[model samples]
Target: MSENNNPPEEKKRPEGITNSYRERLKALKQARQYSVAGDIPKAVERYSTYLYALASYFGVTEDKLSPSFFDTEKEISELLLISHAYWDLSKAYDRSPNLHKESIRCLDQFVKFTNGFKYQHINAQMLKKFIKRKQAHNMKAFQNAYTKIQVDSKGCFIASYSYGPEHTVTNDLRKFKQAIVNYRLGFRFVEVYYNTSPAIINFLEKSGIFGCLLNKVFIRPTLLLISKSARHL
Candidate 1:
């Protein structure tokens, strides 16, 4: 008999795990494409599929795939991806009417999985505060608080912190934002400011003296310039 010359066949991944991984990849691809296309509902559907498949690939149920079940040191990347998916899902739910409770649940999961990571554009701690405030108040109260948060998140962190939410200076800053936000450059500046200012304000608030100093040295001076500019507009 002729000696066998062919190499042994490579071992295949378990069928279930292989299928789960393939589904996860497919769902993730569809989710991102739908998101980029601004088909939020479709994106949300695909994201849900991705999450389920990810859990299956990891040999766990979706709820059991949280940080509590995973080894954080070994699986930080996986946890972060899960956190990001939850965050995106939360944002999608927020845009849908009658899904506030679902949005809050997804935000809670995002916060849980994002324990050590810091994101500039989305303040997870601030989002937790909003969630707590929403649960403790009536719908109207929650709406007002949510509106204030949305406004504050735009670019008025220091102004809102120093002068109070209703202060004339804060109102003036908001009006200035409205005036300039119509222009492309102005909008981009506000976008950058919004992404960066929250962390600065968070730090300042934690240190009282620094907050005071910043208000006097930077915020007040900027407010003065804004006031002067308002006269010209």
Candidate 2:
């Protein structure tokens, strides 16, 4: 018989983990392509997908995919992947017009992951501090805009209708609305909402039971989201 010279096969990851890793890699590749092509929104979408896949690959929820949650002794590769994903995603979000808060969050995650690394370039910690200061400045701007809005102006008609106009919830929703209007396309959206919401509010007011049902189904969840997002801020 002829002597066999074939090398032994390499060990493989389990099928599910391998598939998840492939999905994460594919998303990262697409994100990079979009970033290079100057399609930042698309890049952000793909990077988010990559993060979701990365979380799945590690069998953790997306919120729990941070470095502090991983076991460094056994998951160095996972930690490295998470670090690079956060870094790239932060860069992508930084370029997005409406994603300032998300950009800061991603950068924070990147800084956390890279804290102990010996690579001397980038100075992510310093960059984060600078970005945070800029964010504080932006928040002040948002506050100024909020103050400019007339108190009588029906803010977030749906929210105002659901939670009485003078309620703290309504005021919080107004603040959120002001933040949205500070973004690039946000003013146009507000215009559209202003034009259409009066009629919707009228109808909701007329249909008392239906409006109550809708509030329970819609407004409650929105309030929950707002509460969570406020905590992040």
Candidate 3:
């Protein structure tokens, strides 16, 4: 008298994900060796080559395949190589002509799921940093919000706006402790400050202040790019 029944669930995600990361670590080490052995091209090539292969544990990629999991989202969230592995796979998708847009989509999903806030919490250091960034935001926004809007001889309404903050402390040690976390995990933070988007890009270009921004950034273990507007003297 047997019935169709499944066995009780068991924990599985951590071990596989850990093992996969370890294997990738080994591959990266080999890539370095190749570089040291004077095979720079192969070394660079090996760095992110097998990223998609590591996605088996998650229900990612073309296949909806996932390892037997007690809890899916939490397990993926626990992956230690969350930064590098996902970045590599995202690039893999991007370089593939068939998967270019898909790659961005995949990366967007990964970014949403594992932002710095999830990886790092509001510890004492971060709280102080948050306060500082908020202060900078307020000062700059007020400065811009109050500037007079002028018009030239032409029908054009003469005005200017900025990416704001107009400056980031770069590693700011305090303000970007979260960004440092991501850097320590081996991914670079490459967004413009105060919100850099296509619209912002167009605005900056139209305002003709994009060049000065190149000088204000602090690039280091992490990078910070900020911009603000000032009427020409």
lDDT of 3 by residue, 1-233 (tens): 01212222444556655465446556655765775697755654665543443454343652232223323344443242333344344444544467555545544433433332223221212223433555332333212211110000011100112222222332132233332324523112222221233344455456554434532342211232221111110
How accurate locally is residue 227 in candidate 3, as Cα lDDT from 0 to 100?
Answer: 15
User: Evaluated with TM-score, which candidate comes out highest?
Assistant: 1
Better of 1 and 3 by lDDT: 1
Q: TM-score, each model?
A: 0.45, 0.41, 0.27
Q: Write the per-residue lDDT of candidate 2 for residues 162-193, one digit (tens) a residue.
A: 76667777667666666666665765565465
Query: What is the C-alpha lDDT profile of model 1 across 10-119, one tens digit per residue?
Result: 45656766666655756777898998999999999988987887676556876666777656665566566677688678777876568877776776666566543334
Where in model 2 is the C-alpha error above 4 Å?
A: 1-18, 68-78, 120-233
Kindly report the root-mean-square deviation of model 3 from the true structure over all alpha carbons.
20.1
Error of 1 at 53 (Å): 1.0
> Distance from true position, residue 157, model 2, in Å?
56
